[model samples]
Every structure is written in structure tokens, then in C-alpha cells.
Target chain A: MKIRTSEYIITEVFHSLKRNSWMAFASVGTVAVSLFVFGMFLIIVMNMNRMAVSLESQVEISVYLEDRLTDSEIKAIDKKINEMNGVNSVTFTDKIKALDIFKERLGDQKFLLDAIEGENPLPNSFTVKVVNPSLVKTTAIAINDFEGVETVKYGQDVVEHLFDITRLIRLFGIVLMILLAGATLFIISNTIRLTVFARRTEVAIMKYVGATDWFIRWPFMLEGIVLGAMGGTVAFIALRIAYNMIVAKIYDTIAFFPLIPTYPFMTYISIIIVCCGIVIGAVGSVISLKRFLKA
Target chain B: MIEMKDISKVYENGVVALDHINVSIDKGEFVFIVGASGAGKSTFIRLLFREVLPSSGALIVNGQDVVNMEHGDVPYLRRGLGVIFQDFRLLPDKTVFENVAFAMQVIEAPRRRIQHSVNSVLDIVGLREKYSCFPSQLSGGEQQRVAIARAIVNSPALVIADEPTGNLDPDTSWEIMDIFKKINGGGTTIVMATHDKEIVDIMKKRVIAIEDGHIVRDEAQGAYGYEN
Candidate 1:
């Protein structure tokens, strides 16, 4: 690793790349496309998980009070629910606030609520969120037996189906990511193998001239690193631009849809992808060199 | 600088390349190994450089055990010797100077030493003016000379050439031989495998002839006794 050797290796790598410009282009292109696809799926899986988490966190039990409970009795019920295991927070909404929320949700059709304006039938209810989404059903059932509580409803069937869907999404995302990663490695390595195969005679000559395995391998490994870094940069840029466009489009159309913000999330994804590209590049070169380096 | 005791090579396909060969070469001797095609001459040269292992025998080349040497040590063994091939295996992309300098660079020679040694070796091979020319720009003999320059750039104790003149015309082959003669005169042991009878008879160096996996003759100042 002397300065002279490093200089030689860098020169050799650049020389080989220049000599086999087409092969180098093809290798870098393959790596970029493969990593781009991987990055796209990764972004999708991450955002899906984020959305799933947001949805799950919104699941809460609605505890309606008995028709005419005193304010003190309602406060007692709130305290009791707050002390319950797994209860994250309990917020009581009076009948007037319930009516206001219903009207807001009605949006441009708030005129429908005009027919019942004088008689607010909404009951006082506490929205109870649990520490864990999976505890929603049990927590709701436990809250139903509280004194002075009318009934607890957490949209049991809808919550159950949402959990099932999110679980499926997470499992599918994991399996798909693993499969895509393996495929990317296989393809990138094979592309690198072809480049190495083209220079195999050079390797043989170096070997005969008493070049150590590392001495001969250093240039190729460096070539791989360069190609990988270049490809990773291309993919990172493409992913960033594409994600931003998609985020803008989604925000424009479905403004309420939950998407992970583009700041640290994309930054993290870029780091992971570039690192993957580099590692795959280095590993691919080593694997390709294995057969040729044998004496 | 080489000792082979009861050497034998059996390829995996059950072809016997060499059989029970015993030979010892001193340090500074120019020996030519002559044989017909597939007559085990190549295997003999290959064994000297530890390119292929002996099936069962002991081979000591430049004081290193060729047969039992660790794989990691093969490069060290090869470093002490120079090897040339008939096809003039120069990197097509490298200039003549870089090609020769590559040998020194492989062993991590200092930059100044590499520059100095490469220039001197190029001078020896008479390729000083053609240092910037690629292999494709050179004629067959000139390319071989560049190859020679590269092989000897490190000043190895021994030089091995397999058909160094096989692809050149007679005149060009002789020109390549003159460089080998000059190198050998400088006290480097050279083991060459060739089929050129005229050059062999004229040089009158030690010759070993192999046929069908066995050495049939070993003579000092011997001629290539085979018909073309």
C-alpha cells in the first residue's frame, strides 16, 4: 500500500476502464439499474410501513357515558380508564364537541346536520388510545365494564382487518426486499465477472511475472469500487428525484394520505443503497478473481 | 539453480506428461529443452516455474521447494526468475516502458529504482526509443524484445522462455536469440524450450530432448537433433 503502488493501481484501473469503455459502461449501467429498482422498492416498503404505523396508532376505543352522568362521575370514569393497563391516553369529548366534529367531517354537506341542530343526540365519550394497537380489543372490552359507562366501541371488525392487512404488507415487503437484494447481487456480480473474464489473460501474465494475488487483484477491485460508486451515485440521484416527484404528486392529489417525509428518510435510504453498491462491487470483484488467481 | 528428482506429471485425464525425470541445472547455465509437439517440453518448463505440480517428486527451483511450496509463496519463487512466452504476452494497452516497468512495480520496487531499472533494461533490449509504443505498433521481433525487456527488468537469477522465437521469422528469431545470448552471457541461467534446430545447433548450448514423457538425451553443447 505504498504511495507508488496506490498510484500504479489507480492508473491501472483507469487504463483498463478506458480501454474497455463499453464494458465499463455496461457494468455501471447494470449496477445503477439494479440498485435503482432496489431503492424504489425499499422506499415503497418504508412508506407502506410508515402508513401502517400511523393507521394503527389512530385506533382507539370510544367509551360513551350513560345518558345523564354528573361531571364528577365522568371525571371518575376518566381517571379509572387512565389508570387501566395499556391505556396511553384518554380524552373526553362532550356532546357539543362531538356535534362540531361531525359537522366538520360532513364538509360541504354540513347542511345535512341542520335538520337535527336543536337536538344533539351525540353522547359524551372518551377516546381511549392504548399503548399497543394489538391491545385495542382487550382494552375496549375491559373499559365496557366500568361503572357509569354505557358501552365501548372500537370498530372491532375494521380494526381486525386493518391489522391483518398491515401484517401482510410488512411480511410481503420483507420477503420481496430479500429477493430483490439477492437478484441484484447475482446480476451485478455476473456483470463484473464478464469484465474480469475479458482481462483474464492480463491476470495470467501478471501472475507469471510474479505479481502477488493482491497485487494483481487490487486494480480490478478498485475498478469495481469505482464502477459501484458511480452507479450508486446515479441511482441515488435518480431515487431522490423520483421520490420527490412522487411525493409532490401524491400530495397534490391525495393530500391526506400518509407518506414518510423526504428529509432524513431519503438520506438514510441513500446511505444504505450506496453502501450496498460498494459492498456488492467489492464482493463481486473478489468472487470473480477467485478462479483466475488460482495457481 | 534447479533440482528435479524422480519427477512425474500425470494430468487428470490420465495423460502422463513427464515420467521419473531427474535433472539438475547449475546457476548460470543456458539450457535448451527441445521436443516435438506434446512431448512434455512445455510441462518441464511449467514445472520449473511451479505452474503445475509434480504428481510425485521433489522440485527445488532457486532454493525454493516447487512441489511442496505454499501457494502464497509461489509469487516469491516466480519473482526470483523471469518467464517469457511465445505470444509476447504484453498488456495490449500498456506502452513498452510501462510493460517493462510493470514487472518491477509488481514486486513493489521503489519508484526511482523502477524508473532506473526499466530504462536500463529497455536499453539492454534495444527498445529505448520505442518505450512509448504499444505492442500492436511493433513488429513481431520488436514485441518479443519488449517482452524480453519486461522479463529481465527485475534482473532475476534465472530466465525461462517457452518458444520465444516460435512465431517470428528466421531472421527475427535470430535477433531475439542474440538478446538471449547477451542476457545469458551476463550470468543469468536461461532455460528455453524451442523447436528451432538452426538456432540450437549454432548456439551449441546444453540441450535436453524429451519424447513421450521422458528425456531421451541430455548433452552439453548439443544441437536440436529433431527433423523439422
Candidate 2:
């Protein structure tokens, strides 16, 4: 097709949209709202995962050394623990230092300190920060084999349960996105199908007139794309405004929650919304066109 | 040229619409396919356009084996022919100019070419003044003229009119026939399917008569042969 004619087709498509502005707007509005919900949920799930990771980082593993270890042996074990996979950092806390910190906490409890006597019962230890808190078991196992290490003391049950919760959340979040994507496709396709059905005669006549399939298809495809993108833009704007409002209201109460990534996440979702809108609109137009183009 | 060699069409219910219809028309010939309702005239014309496939036999239009034509080539093939309907089938919402321009738009005719061609055809149909008029705004005859203008604007090799005057008064029908004659005079072959006996007789063109899904007569300068 000539470039000029292609422009005319686009003109016709946009003109049709204007003529049916109310209907077009309604359809686009639905797409925007649906995608907004999907995008908002996505940001929420991502932030929640971030929060979980932050909380997990605070739980450190302490590896106690056996009393018989020489300075060289302790140094060798420290090096091994630090070199282990998933161990982020290792700091040696000498037995005397650990007792001094305990005493500082129990300032008026001289009797309690006396019960422990002058002899320090605490073992010298290395506090380990794991790069991945979810891999605590693996890190504990690696440390357990160290020659002078007495025990790897991370709260096993709590870490395992927390890890399981994060995994479940991530899985459910993915499944939800998949289901919502499918729903968006379905709704957009049905909407375009109705538009195609309403203008089946136009499509039939265009075909009979010897119009190329693409020539006929371009306008409808453009219409779909426009609808999707408009919807996505509206949704993105609504989400941004809504997120800002919610964040402002809950800032103090939710101090433990990480700072909102509203701007960056909005940018990411805008890209997704535009892409999804275009894809869905094209798909919808294609489905509706398939049956009507037989002429 | 258009030719149908022993073409037959049978619906799935075993009702035959056309039975072994063998016919041919040379380029520039103006012929009439005259038959009563359900006599298979529509089916015969529809076959040439590949709108309906012949259940058996070969149908060729301008050397293309339309009977075996692939689905993708149908539109390209149709671009070489124009099909007009009895109901005038102009989009009511579009102005007369838009209706004519639609033909060129489908073929991706450039804006300048489409504008030039639509104006020229509208002039030929003597409706240049009604360019902005919608189908509903025009009279029955005027709307049919717009339909004819759309059909012929592309300078197609063939123009198929199915009961072109079926919905018009005798006076308006005659006006439409004059427009068809003018188009035929321009060297485009014309095939019209109609039940208007008086008009067919007056035109005195070659008439192919069909009855009960079969061609009953083929005569040069013939009249509508059968009476109701």
C-alpha cells in the first residue's frame, strides 16, 4: 500500500474513534482500571518482598569456638567461616568483650555477675551475616564442620518458617499476575470483538472492494492500540496519585516499612501498561477480524 | 473475460443453487442474467467473485482459476472486479464522496489519487454536486448511482450488479440502467442479474435465462423469456 493510503486508513480509524468517543472512552477506562489494579498489586508484592529481605538481614548467626582452640586455630576457623558461601561477613567477639557487654546490660545486677563468678562461661565466637538469610541451614552446616567451632547458633525454626512464607508470597504473586494478564486479554478482546461485530458490514465491504488484509487490518489494529495505551496511561496516573496519598497518610505508622519506590515503580508500570495495552489491543483486533475477513 | 465451465453449487442440505452452469462473456460485453427469485442468478455471479465456491467445475475470471483460487488472493482478484448490490449498500453514515473514496482507500490508493479518482467518477455519475450528501439524504436512484460510482471508480475490468434496480421505481431504474450503459460504453464488461422484465426487454442485450438451478436459454439481443 502507498504511504498516503496508509495515512488515510489511520485517519479513518481515528475518525471512527472520535465518532464513537463515548464508547471508546468507556472501553479504555475499563482497561486502565484493570491494569492499574494489576500494577498496584505488583508494586505491593515487590515492596513486601523487600521488607521481608530487610527483616531477614537482621538475624545473624553466631558460631561459638571451643575453649581449647589456640589463637592460630581460632584464626584458621574464622578464615574458613568467612570464606564459606552465603556468609556475608564474620566478626570475632572475644569472650571478655561478650561478658563486658553482658555486664553493661546488667549494671545493677552485681549479684547476677557474681553468680557467674570471675571465670567467663561464654565461648569466644564469630558473628556471621549471611548474604542470603534463606540459606541459613547451608551456612550453619558449612560452619559446623570447622575444627574449633563448637556450634552454629542461628534460630533454625524461625528462619525456616520465615523463608517458607517469602517463598509462598513470591509464588502467589506470580500466579496472580498470570491470572490478571489473562483476564486483561479476555476483556480487551471481547471489547474489540464487539466493535468489530458492530462494523462487520464495513469490514465485509472493504474486503469485497479488494482491499488488502493489512490495509483493512491496520485501522482496527491502531484503534485497539490507542485504546490500550490510553487505558494504561489513565491507570498509571491514577495509581501514582493513589500511591502518593496512601504513603503520605501512613508514613509515621509504617516507619518500619522501607521507603516507597513509587516514582521508580510508576515508571516501570507505565512501560508495562503501554506495552500490555498495545499487545492486548492488537490481539483483540486480530481475533475479531479473523472471522469477519472471510469475505 | 469471465467463464464458468460446468460450475455447480450445492448447499450442505443438498439444495443446489446452480447446476452445471457453463457460460462465458467477452470483455466489454453487457449481458443480463435474467431469472426469477431463487433461479440461481445470484449464485452464478457470486461464483465469479469467489464469494461462494462452485461445488464442482472450473470458474475463471480474466484467466484466473477463481474456483481454485487461494483465500489470500481473493481480495487482489476482487480489486479487478466491482460488485454492486440491489440495496445500494452504501454506508448510510458516509457521505457520497466518502462512499466512492472507500473503493480507492481499500486498494491503498494515495490521497491525491483517491481524491482525483473519486471526483472524476462522481462527475461521470453526474453526482459531483451531491458529494457531501449521505446515502439517506439522496433519493433511491441517487444512492444507487453512488453505489455504481464506487463500483466503477477503480476502473475495474468487470462490474457485477445484482438487481441494480430491484428496489427502485421504473423511472429511477431506467436512470440507473443509463448509468450502467455509460459504464459499459467505457469498455468495462457488465453482468447484471435482475427480474425486471420490462427493463431487460427495453435494453435488448444478450440475456441468459436460468430456471431451477440450470441455464434454460442463452440468446443475443433477447427479451426476458419467462412469464410469472
Candidate 3:
């Protein structure tokens, strides 16, 4: 572990990289491209999943009450729905107010409402929002079974399909990330292999001269790690710049899309990507040297 | 020191490279193995460095049982050896100093000591002024000399040269031989395999001759006593 020896190894690694600059660039480029896609996919998945959760949370169920109920009876039913499990809030609207809402909803059709002027046909209802949107359907069904409830609806079909698609997309993102990691390792090692193959004679010479296997392996491993880190850094910077631009554009046009705010979340993601790069680099170098290092 | 009671090697293709080769080389002895092509010289040299295992025999080098040694122990066994090759296997891009310095670096020698020993070895090979020269910049003889300096830099007890002068001219071969003699006289055991008859005939050392996988002769103070 002499400083001089370490310096020699570092210089040797850098020299070899300089000598095979073309292959070195190719290795870095491959790593950068693969990791860039992986980072982008991760960012997008984070935002999409957050957006889905937000949309799910905003869903509310409407329970139309049985007709001919008095004010006290309606109050009693409103209190019952509010006390139900998972119900965040419940607001009761009587037939008179329902009629007013109908009139507002049909601004140009006020004459149609005047035709039934003396008789109010709208049903009084309770609009209930739940803590967890996923439990909305079950809570609605439970309320529908209540004595004063006539019907319950919460955009049942559309919400179910949305959840399924989000789950599929999450699964796909995980698989793609794993595949990209493998591809990065393969390319980095193969590219470094060309450099190692070129100097196999040096390895043979070192072997014959009684240099230990690790002694011969250190410089090559160092080279690969540096190459991998370089690729990771490049990919991280590219992802950050591109992500900031897209996030700005998305906010300016359609601000409702729920994005993971760029702060600690981005910092954590960058660390993960860079660490992957380093690990891939180390593993690739070790794998490529396995055959040659065998005594 | 080296001992081979009954060493034999058979390739997978059924070629018998060496057969029942029994010989003993003592410590600090300079032995030359002379043979024609396919006469088992290379195999014998390789066996000393544990480059290949013996098919059947008891082989020991420097008091270590080499025949039954595991794969991981081979490098340690080699560390006691200074191996030179026919190709002058110098790193093409490293300067002569770095090439020699590399040996000590592999063994983790301190910088001051490495500097001192490398300089002295370069002086021994008479290449002190050519330390900064690359392999391509040096002539064949000078490069072989650089190879020799690298081999001895680690201060190994035994030096194995497999056709060290195979690619050198007559004068350069003599110069390389002179360095080996100097190294051997300094108490390092030298086992060199070569077919350079003129130089071997001139330098009367202990010569061991192999023919058809058998040791035909093991003579002390002997000449290269074989004809092509």
C-alpha cells in the first residue's frame, strides 16, 4: 500500500485509458445512455404514481336518500353516513337545494325546470368523501345497504381500470430498470475487455515475474470504476437538466399533474443511479478479469 | 534448490513432453538445459515455475512441495523466481526504469529501496543512461538487458531463463549471458534453457541435456555437448 505503488497503478490505468480513448469513450457512452433511460423512467414513474394517488384521493361517492323523509329524519341519515368507516366528510342536500343545483347546472334549460314549478322531483342526497379512495367502492356499497339510502355511485368502473393500468405501468418500469442495469454491465465489461485483451501480454509478464494476482488486477479494476462513475455522473447531469426543463413545461401548460417535488427526492434518486454505476463498474471489471486472474 | 524424483508430463493430445525426468539442482548452482525443438526443455522450464503440473512425480522447488501445491500458492512460489522469456517480454509503453520498477512495485517494495535497487541493477546491466528509454527505442540487446534488470529487481533466489537469447544476435547474447553469470555468481541459482551452442560451449557451466523426454546427461562444469 505504498503511496508510490498506488500512484503507479493510477497512472497506469489513466495511461491505458488514454491509449484506448476510442473504446473508453464507447464504454462511457453506452453506460450513460442506458443509465439516462433508467433515470428518466424512474422519474416519470414517480410522478405518474403520485398523480394517480392524488386523483384517487379526490373521488367522492354520492348516496341518494329515500324520498318522503322529514328534516329530522334527513339529519339522522346524514349523521349516520358521516359516522361510517372511511368517510372523511358528508354533506346533505335536500330536494329544494337539489332543485336549485339542477337549475344552475342547466342554465339555458330554466324553462324545463319551470314546467314542474310547484313539484320538486329531485332526490335529497349525501355526498361522502373517503380517507382512502381505494375503499370508496366498498364504503359506497355499505351505505347503499342502509335503510334511508336508495343508490350509491363513485365512478366505479373508471377508477378500477385506472388502478389496474397504473399497477401494470409500475411493473413494467421495474423490469425495464433491471434489464438496463444488466445491459450496462455487459457493455462496460466488454469494452474494458478490449483494453484488457490488448495487454494480456503484460499480464502474462507480470504472472511470470511473480506478481500476485491482485497486484495485476488492481489497475484494471480502478480503470473500470472510474469509467463507470464517469458515465453515471454524465447521466445524472443529463437527467437533471432534462427533468427540470420538462417539469417547467408541464407546470406552465397543465399544472394539475402531480410531480414529486425536486428536492430530497431527486437527491436520493441521483445517489441510487450513481451507486448503480459504481457497482456495475466494479462487477464488470471483476468478471472480465476472472479468467485471467485464475492461477 | 530443486528436486525432481520422477517427473512426467503427458498432454491431452497424447504427446509426451517429458518422461521419468529425474534430476537434482542444488542451491546457487548455475544449470543449463540444452535440447532441440520438442526435446522437453520448455516443459521442464515451465514445470519449475508451476506453469504446468507434473502428470506424475515428486517435484519440489526452494523447499516447497510444488507437485501437490494448490493453484493459489503458485504465485508465491513464482515470487521466489526471476523468470525471463525468449520474447524479452518488456512492457512496450513503459520506460526501462518503470519496467524494472514494476517488479518491485508488484511486491510492494518501498520507494527509496526500489529506487536504490533498480538503479544498481541498471548499473549491473550497464543500462544506467537508458532508464528513460522505451522498449522500442532500445536495440534488441538493450531490451533484453532491460528484461534481465526487471527479472532480478525483486532479488529472487532463483532465476529461470527460457531461451533468453533466442532472439538476440551473437554479441548481444554474450552480453546477456555475462549479466546472468554475474547474477549467478552473486549466490542466485540460475536455471537457463537454451540452444545457443556457441555461447554455451564458451561458458563452461553445469549442463543438463534432454532428448526425447529423457535426461541424457547431467554434467558439472560441462559444455553445450549436443549437436543439432
lDDT (CA) for every model shown? 0.92, 0.86, 0.87
Which residue pairs collide, candidate 1? none
Candidate 3 iRMSD, 1 decimal = 1.5
1 or 3, greater by DockQ: 1
Q: What is candidate 2's CA lDDT for residue A215?
A: 79
Candidate 1 residues B1-228, lDDT tens each? Answer: 999999999999999999999999999999999999999999999999988999999999999988888899999999999999999999888899989988888899998998899999989989899999999999999999999999898899999999999999999999899999999999999999999999999999999999999999999999999899
Query: All candidates' TM-scores?
Result: 0.87, 0.90, 0.85
Ranked by lDDT, top first: 1, 3, 2
- Which lDDT value does model 2 have at B141? 91
lDDT, candidate 1, residue B215?
A: 95
Model 1's lDDT to the true fold?
0.92
* Candidate No. with top lDDT: 1
Error of 3 at A7 (Å): 3.4
Residue A158 CA displacement from its true place in model 3, Å: 4.8
Against the native complex, each candidate's DockQ, computed on alpha carbons, is 0.70, 0.66, 0.60
lDDT for B41 (candidate 3):
98
Fnat, 2 decimals, each candidate: 0.80, 0.80, 0.66
Worst 10 residues of 2 chain B by lDDT: B104-113
